[model samples]
Target: MRAGGNIEITDLMRFGHLAAAVFAGWILIAPSIDCARRGLQRETPLSEWEHMDTFTTQQGCESYRATVIEAEKADSKNLYNARYAYSLCVRDDDPRIKGE
Candidate 1:
């Protein structure tokens, strides 16, 4: 009714249109952002997996022994670290690891 004053319905419609536009823009952009963040942009070379399988099987018995030894070491180390971290968490005031 006054100068520079729009009607209530017009204002509400404008606000809704603006909100819809923003939402549409976000919907379009979100998947692209996720894909880039998740490294989907990188194209894997076709031969890489083939080469890895060939190399793994070619080493035969030695590779199997080495893999088992490494796995055992990793398991022991993880167990030790987990226990130490849990004990430290109990002593601290942080509620992250504390549970009922």
Candidate 2:
């Protein structure tokens, strides 16, 4: 990206690589849920958790997700907020989130 919204060639190349890699790897699905309404805060690609980088492998995604869960468990935060009990890892190409 540059001034006047011009996309640089380098940016296109990077996006091309990422687009290809998206089909070959895993993505961590870290969704925060509103328990009372049983509503999901990650029902779209624009969700805040989408900012997390994609993992190149399921093992990597699982390892990171587990660490997050452990941290959440250890932290005695207020329960009035959100919960990540439904957080998980899914293939990047999964139909549910891949917009297929």
Candidate 3:
């Protein structure tokens, strides 16, 4: 967290592998969802997804997700074409981001 309790992008990259911290707030799961090849990735556990930075508010989480998707679009390798490969903004307590 910086001077404003805001997380830097680099921090997210550094800790991307640790998806579910289950903080007291909310979190964004920016997993690599290739439904075309994996079929919704339902067999994969949420903890395996690439976790984005945590947010205190739903609006903030969605805003960051949009920002990330926009940036990903610039990269030709992004998974925007997938049927369900978008970041999810859910409360840390959400069971979906936990053990299956």
Q: Per-candidate TM vs. native?
A: 0.19, 0.51, 0.53
Clashes of 3: 0
The candidates, ranked best first by lDDT, are: 3, 2, 1
Candidate 1 local lDDT, residue 30: 8
What's the lDDT of the predicted structure labeled candidate 1?
Answer: 0.32
On a 0 to 100 scale, what is the lDDT of residue 53 in model 2? 48
Candidate 3, residue 6: the lDDT equals: 90
lDDT of each: 0.32, 0.64, 0.66
- Candidate 2 per-residue C-alpha lDDT over 1-100 given as tens digits, one digit per residue, 9 for 90 to 100: 5667898898889999897876687776655555786666756452344425488888998888777667677655634123344566777667766555
- Top-down TM-score ranking: 3, 2, 1
Better of 1 and 2 by TM-score: 2
What lDDT tens digits, residue by residue, belong to model 3 across residues 1-100? 5666898888887686455443357788756566577534545667766666888888998887777666666665545523224567878877777764
Worst 10 residues of 2 by lDDT: 78-87
Per lDDT, the best of the predicted structures is 3
Over 4 Å off in model 3, which ranges? 1-23, 32-43, 79-85
